[model samples]
Target chain A: MSPVHLEAVCKLYRGRQQLSWRRLLRPQPPDPPHIALQDISINLPKGNVLGIVGRNGAGKSTLLKIVAGTLAPTSGLVQVAQPVAAILELGSGFHPELTGWDNALLGLALLGLDAGASQQALSDIADFAQLGSAMERPIKTYSTGMVVRLAFAVTTCLHPEVLILDEALSVGDGAFARRSFERIMQFRRDGATILFCSHSLYHIEALADRVIWLDGGRIVADGAPQHVLRDYQHFLDQAPETQTPALPQAGLARGHAALEQHRIPARLRRIRVNGQPAGQAVELTCLQSTLRIEVDFTSDPSLPAPGVGFIITTPDGRSITSTSTIADGIVIGRDVHGSGTVILEFPDLPLLRGLYVLAVYLLSEDGLLVYEELPQAAELQVHSPGPELGYVLLPRRWLPLGNGHAAPDCKPSAHRYIRT
Target chain B: MRGVLLLLRRLIRAYGQGFYQPWQLALRHRHLLRQLLGRDAIIQTAGTHLGRLWLLLGPGLQILAWWFVFDAVLRVRPMARFSFLDYFLPSVLPWLLVQETLSRCLSLLREVRSLYERSIFPLAILPLLPLLLVWMIYTPLEAAVVAILHGPQAALAATGFMVVLAWLLLPWCYIFSLLGIFFPDGAYGMRFLLTLLFYFTPILYAPQMLPENLQDILAWNPMATLLQQLHGLIGLAALDLHHAWYPLACSLLVTGPAWVLFRRMSIQIREAL
Candidate 1:
């Protein structure tokens, strides 16, 4: 069996409604509304740390709660092959009126330890919490950091088969955070499966073997940490641009287009433009009449300049602009034949709103073109600008004459004034 | 039947651990309970000048007010055989103990819910603490009052009877403690119900003063019977040993179910809190 399996899980929160007393008196069926999770499925192996990353209100905590059995899923099943413990919120079950020693024992008891076992564990937790004599004082007198430290100490002592941490590490000082990380590593070493929810990218990268990206209450991507994180970042960057520009056709074009031929001897794999792969690049419309060029290039150690550049122009081949790695003060020093990607972005186009061509070149520092694309390798059309004037407009200010003053004659200047 | 047995076994085990292992736990983490009690006592009397004395003073003043109102304002006389103070003091003293004990018994779990929710401590002890505090305060005042109104023999006898009654009431205390944790509104409901119970009890009015039919009804109140036993020892009245064993037997019978309810509800209480 999978260590943890969430099959077609769904969660819904009931929104409060105002009902008349008459309606309240006559009971009605609960409303079907507010779906937080829609058919999510996950199968996690034992002893692997999984990090869940999501924007606010994306249902990460709800998913964790369901996994921890603190909450039941509205539909579907969450099956765990091992015992689970959660530090969902630090000091969640702690009593402010109880002493630290009492809370430690209480936390342990709640985790299913008998009194004898809890008593035995309390000393270690107390030492780890480092409250010293303060442990005798009521928890209300303890600082927030002290509370978190005590909670972390007690929770880590449980030795659970599956440990779920939900943003508990966000509290405490840096030293305490470091200590928590060390304890978590120890837990991992004890062959426990961990599901950690955090906004700390560094911690996620350092600890998680796999990462799940949640968007709009759905699992958008799940894979090795680096790959999933890169995809999530790209998703974040592209989502807003796509929404604002109505770029569905552009998306299709970017997905459909393919690289027919290439002269440069570079291994280019998994090329994506505008967040869509190169094989399906045809769907993308170059909205800004500007092309974003990226290529994976590898070179022999002897080659000084294994650089790539691109030129954008009208279909008539009037070159608009071009730049190269050598011109940008980058030096290719080794024949290491190692691979790296180069990116060039053209912010705006001077050409009129019409079809344009893109030309590509791979050259050395001596100006020898190792590879070149003829006049029009890629073609894109720039749609007519709406009512807005010029390529870009500035918000201008004008002052009117006061009542007693005569108005000075003024005319539009030869040079258009643009606000920075 | 098996589930019931299993639940009982578990409760027994839990209670045994809490009672027996407290010293081991306390020794390791010394002064934890003391600190909790101290904080509770201090916060309870923070703004008051008397501070911890309020624990004693508040109840003392309450007794004084009750005495003044009943004797002066109402001009009420004691039963023919008993003086006003002699009759009223014994009844009201125990009544106060029962009220204070019962009201606080149910609230103990709620007032310290935070402690139950967070720590590995057995929650049973939390409810016991409040009851213990009330007992400490009530016991001394009870002795002093009996000594002043009656002779040394009567005072010692009354104290002995009160101690015995307290022991008999342990099961009820435990039941209320658990009820406090499980039922969020248990304390308020108990208070409202106990208000009616106070009148029915023989605290404010002697049972003999009621009509014969009503006397039978009043005698049904376990609190009234307990008070009568207490008053008898203090020489304020004759001991009515007849039907005395009934309330004791009834209390014993009720205790079994009450304990079962407490055990069953404790699990749910942990989750609810």
Candidate 2:
């Protein structure tokens, strides 16, 4: 049986309303609930390591808390076959006034160990905590690392069947962090299930067999670690900078059309490639790979084979390349109207690792006037891991300049691609 | 009738399991309970200059203050057949024990909310541990004091009364613990009510000091019954078995609802925290 199962879990947090005398005297409708998780279902079998990755406020922590049984979902069924031990937050409940020894014993008790079992486990916990005589000193006297050590030791020593961790390993120095990972690995070997949530993709990549990516309180993607991580990386690549255009006050109606112009065209919506939602950024694993861009749009019925054009430019507005259907001499034989989609295929595409802006234009069939021009429609990010750095990869070869020694053993070599 | 029978079966199963499972866990994990209690005791006394002696000194001072206020300042009569010190000491000690247990159990779920956030365990015993800790510290010392003042028989009887007092206080403590989690002002309300309860109880003065009608109503107070029974046990008042059995029955009856409330609120407490 699966060690953990969550079905149709939804958590709604009611906002705390400000209490007033009048409000107290008269009953008022409660504040609307904030949707923390919506229709989340998961099943984690024993020994499976599930990594949760998401931007802040993505409900990763909420999901972990639900599994840990600290927070009950508003509506759902949760079943866990074995006892759960969690380190949901670092230094979560460790009392500052209590000594390390006392805190460990208390933690053990809270974890369901009786006094004698906690005492028996105390020595192992001490050895793991490595606080030495400092174990007797209050936790407030210990450093942050010491506190983490004590928490980690007490939690891991219990050998819980299902462990849920929420960014708990982010602290601690190098060696200690590695040792903690080793301990988690040992738990994995012992067939214990783990739910690990972290912002660190490297840890998730190294540790998780499966990954779930959450966005806006919903699981947007869930699958193999590499696939989900790649998709998330693509989202991050196109994510807007910290500075966003501030909205004007309601009273300031003037110049609102200028802001309206900044918004992407409603007619041309949704971009994807190879069955993956590309959004404003597309991720490619190889430098020279087939690049397909599918654009779903509402077309004007009167326009017959209206031309489409796109321009690629550097982040600072230097145009690198531009293409147009009119220039390419590709004829759209039939007139299209209403909802239509255009597929732009670029085989063996060449691009460099850097942020590039993509601007798209819709033109009249004659290509004389611009029907719609969207500037900086998307930001294209090309990132391929390698030591080589340049604007594009080229098929250049060295022939020993002056034909020295006849370029011994000149033969085609097997190509290797970097897998990062 | 079938539905009622099913409901009854369910209630019995739920309440029975709730009651038995915690004690079963407590027995199995007696070490954990002991360690937790020991930690509380250590933290209480470790930093103070008085140290472990504060276990007695703290309550001893309170007893002395009561003795001074009533016996010396007020020049109060015993009202019972025995002396004021003999009558009040045995009864007042247990009274204070129950009072502290209830008050301490109040806001206990919130105090341990952060701990529960970290791990899962049989949470029903949270209020029980503090009571046990208080009992572990004061009962033996107070029992010895009773032996010195009275005799071995009285001490044994006092010990038995202490056990009974713990049993009587358990369900109420659990009830208030859940209340403290749900209501932010519950602890303060409980404190105010307990102060009122302390006065209504026949702690400072004997039941004979009250008017005849008032004594009859006060007889219904469980604390008063327990105190009167304790006084009986120690030879300070009349030994009537009804006083003991009636209150025990009432307390036991209250446990059914308290246990149901506990089971219901257990889920909510996690949410509230």
Candidate 3:
């Protein structure tokens, strides 16, 4: 049996309303619950390292919390292996007044250790925390790094059969962070099933065998870490400087978009490539005529106009290059009717012989919450006549062997097709 | 013992098996529970000059105050066969435990909300916390005090009574702990009510001092029955099993609803926090 398994799990949270005489008399309907997770299902076998990645309010932490058994799902079946230990946050739940030694004892005990095991784990924790004599002192006096060290040592020492971590790798800096990471790697080597949720794609790629990407309480992508991270990284690349906090947080600790169901932020209405009517998968020639793509969208009229973003990637979702109105600080103009049209022109399309997918996204005015995604909406098929190689044709020319002068037709000029 | 076990089993089985969850948490994390209880004591006395001695000193000081008021200032004596000190000493200690436990329940969940936020803190065992702590600290101490005043037999009987009292207070513990989350003002309301109950209990003074009608009212108070049984154990009053009916019935009535309410509102309590 899989160490971690979930079927159609969901968690819903509703904002609390204050009691008032008016509310008592008027009896207004309660606001709709915020969707943390909806019909999320997973079956992670033992020794499988799973990573969770998503934007703020994406319910990655919610899914982790559900699996960790901290938060009960509003609905669905969840079967996880026994003796699950979790490090959901740094310096989580330690009393400031307690000594480091005492805190470790408590932490290990909280992780389901009995008295003898907790006492035995103390030496291991002492070695790992490296607090030395300072371990006898109260935790409040210790530096942030010291607290994190102690917490990490206590959590990892038990070698829990099924360990779950939420951004715990973002431990304190310098040699200790590397040590902590190495310890996680050691756990992986020991065949422990780990469910790691982090915003650091690098860590996810380095550690996770599988990855799940969540958005608006739903799984947008789930597969190999590389593939899922590519999709998630693409979303982040589109709107890198959104107003909403991009920092990942533990489940239910970060603020959620309450009553998100009631709002219609933005939606893609129409798309046209090079003035040709678009199909579900529009195949267009590259390195020939100029490529003009038009996107028509609608937004909530009362709110700020949403941003438009598009990405060109290999068929497997490794992003080649992407552009966004938000990233360029361009304010999309929308009419009072909430309809807006933006046209992107790629002159002298220089993409070489390759099949590329174009994805369109409608971002919220703040450029964080993705309103709609048309993934692989358009496919570009390029077959160049010249004997050039690579995914992109550089704007350059080869000089003749007998002379230093370049051919007149192949002269280098300041153009948009500069290779990186 | 067999009869008691049968009733306990019936109670657990009656509560829809959710009763077992708290038991499981308590058993699985018993070490954590012990550590947390120790931590609570450490936090109370950590910075203090006297340190762990303050556990007894704090109570000793309160007992001194009560002694000064009732014994010296008011010059109150028991209306029954025993002296005021004999009756007051045994009963007042348990009342103090009740007062502290019920009052402490007010902010119990809130105090640990941050802890539960980032970890899967087993909260079902929380209400049991105050009870267990009180039991750990005072059960032996109170029994010792009873032994010094009475004899070994009375001390043994008082110890059993204290144990039963701890078990019986579970419903009250859970009720107040949850009320502390959903209705914070209930703490203050309970405080005032407990003060009223303290006067009515017959712990401070004997029941014979009150009017016939007020004495009848004291029959419903569990603390009164506890003192009566304790007094009986010391050979100061008649030992009758029939008087035990009200307190047991009261526990059953309170526990049935308290456990159900906790099981139902356990999730909501976390949200409220």
Find the candidate with the highest TM-score and give its number.
3
Model 2 residue pairs with clashes: A114-B29, A114-B31, A114-B32, A115-B31, A115-B32, A116-B31
* Prediction 2 TM-score vs. true: 0.71
The local distance difference test score of each candidate is 0.65, 0.72, 0.76
Residue-wise lDDT of candidate 1 within B1-273, one digit each (tens)?
999999989767665543334334434443445445555676577657788999878877887887788877886676876667778877787777778888878777767765554333455445445555666667777888898888878888878876766655656777777666545465568889889899898776777778889988876788888877777778778877776786687556555565556545554465555
Q: Each candidate's root-mean-square deviation in Å? A: 17.7, 18.4, 15.6
- Candidate 1 — which residues are off by over 4 angstroms? A1-86, A92-143, A146-164, A187-195, A199-202, A209-420, B1-43, B46-51, B71-85, B105-110, B116-129, B136-190, B211-217, B233-235, B245-273
Every candidate's DockQ is 0.12, 0.32, 0.43
TM-score of each: 0.54, 0.71, 0.72
In terms of lDDT, model 3 sits at 0.76
Docking quality (DockQ) of candidate 3: 0.43
lDDT of 3 by residue, B98-177 (tens): 87887777777887776677787777788888788877778888889889888889899988988778767878888898
- Kindly list the per-residue Cα lDDT of model 3 for residues A191-296, writing each as its tens digit: 8899988765756887789999899999899999888887777787676464321221212111112113323455667777766544444444445556678988
Candidate with the larger TM-score of 1 and 3:
3
lDDT of 2 by residue, A1-420 (tens): 699899999988876544445567897887787899999889987899999998889999889888987777889899986678787766666777788888887787767776667789999988876778999888989988889888888878878799888886433543355457668777888988999898767568867889999988899999999999999877865766332212211221112242244321123444555455533565554355566766555444443556677776776545567787887887544334344567787665566677766666655454534445566555667665555565555555555657474444422221434443
